[model samples]
Target: MTEHRPVNITGLALKIPPALIFILWIAMMATLRYIFPGLNYELFLTPYVVGLFFILGIFLVLAGFFSFRKAKTTINPRKPEKTTAIVTSGIFRLSRNPMYLGFLMWVIAWAFMQANLVTFVFLPLFVFYMNRYQIIPEEKILLSQFGDIYYRYLNKVGRWL
Candidate 1:
C-alpha cells in the first residue's frame, strides 16, 4: 500500500522509547532531589526564573504557532503529511522545533519557579522522548519529503539548537 516497506518497529514503539527515556530521567532527577534537598547544581532558580521563563516560554509558543501556521501541511503526528515549505523565518530560525522547545521551557519553568521536584522530571524526559522518537521520526519524514534541500538544512541547522 505504501512506497517503502515499513520498518520493523511501529510508530508507537518509536514514540515510546523516548518517553521511557524521559521517564527514567525524571526518576533520576527525583532521586537526586530526594537524596540532596539543598542541591542547586542544575537548578536555574534565580529571581529571574519566573519572569525569564514566562517570556521565553511565551516566545517559544508563539514561534511554534507561527511555524505551524507557515507550514504546508498539518502538524498532526498520527497522519504524516509532506511539508512544502522550509520555514527559516521567525522562530524557525531560533530552534528547529520551537513547539517542543516551548514545552521544554514549560518544564523548566514549572520546576524552578514552583520549586517542585516532581514537575522538574518532565524537562529531561521531554527532551529524551522528543529527540529519540518524535524528532527522529519527523526528520525521516522531512528528509523523505524534502530530499536534498532538507539534508542541506539539516547540515546548516541543528535539531534543537
Candidate 2:
C-alpha cells in the first residue's frame, strides 16, 4: 500500500502567501511605472547597489547550479517530489537552501534594479516562504530517508550560511 503523506499546513500557507504577494508586487510595480513615467528604479543597475546585487546574483546562481549538478537533483522548489538525491556539496556545504538563496539574490537584484521601495516587500516574503515550505519539509524528508547521515551533514552545514 502506498502511504500518502499529508501536506504541511505551514508549507501551504507559505507557498500561497508569497506567490500572491509576488503577483501583487509585480502588479503594483507595473502600475506605478505607468503612473510615473520618469521614475527609474533599477535595483540591479543602481549606482553602488548594482555591483552588490550583480555579484550576489551571480554568486547565488553559480552556487546553486554547482550544488544541484553535484547532487544530480532538481532545484525546483515547486516539485520537490521529484528530487532523486540529497545535495550536500559545493554551495550546499555552505547553505542548505541554495536555490532559495539564489531566489533571494534575484529579489535583491530586482530591488536594486527597480530601485522601487515597494519591491522590498517581496524580499522578506520570499525568504519566509522558502524557509517554511521548501527547507523545512525537505529537511524532514531528508532526515527520514537518509537517517543519521543527513543529520551529520546538517550539523556540518548551516541552514543559511
Q: Report the lDDT tens digits of candidate 1 across residue range 1-161.
A: 12422334355534443324434654655666666566544545455785787678788877776677777555554333345566777777767777667656655755675454565656766777677767877777766666777677788777777
Q: Which sections of candidate 2 miss by over 4 Å? A: 1-45, 79-81
Residue 112 CA error for candidate 2 (Å)? 2.0
Q: Any residue pairs clashing in model 1, and if so which?
A: 18-129, 22-125
**Local accuracy of candidate 2 as per-residue lDDT tens digits, 1-161:** 12334444442633543345445655665566556656555433376775676677678777887778777887665555566777777777788766556556656665666665655666777677667766777676666656677788889998777
State the RMSD for candidate 2. 5.0
Total backbone collisions, model 1: 2
Candidate 1's displacement at residue 133, Å, is 1.7
Error of 2 at 120 (Å): 2.1
Q: Rate the local accuracy (lDDT) of all candidates.
A: 0.63, 0.64
The per-residue C-alpha lDDT of model 1 at residue 70 equals 71
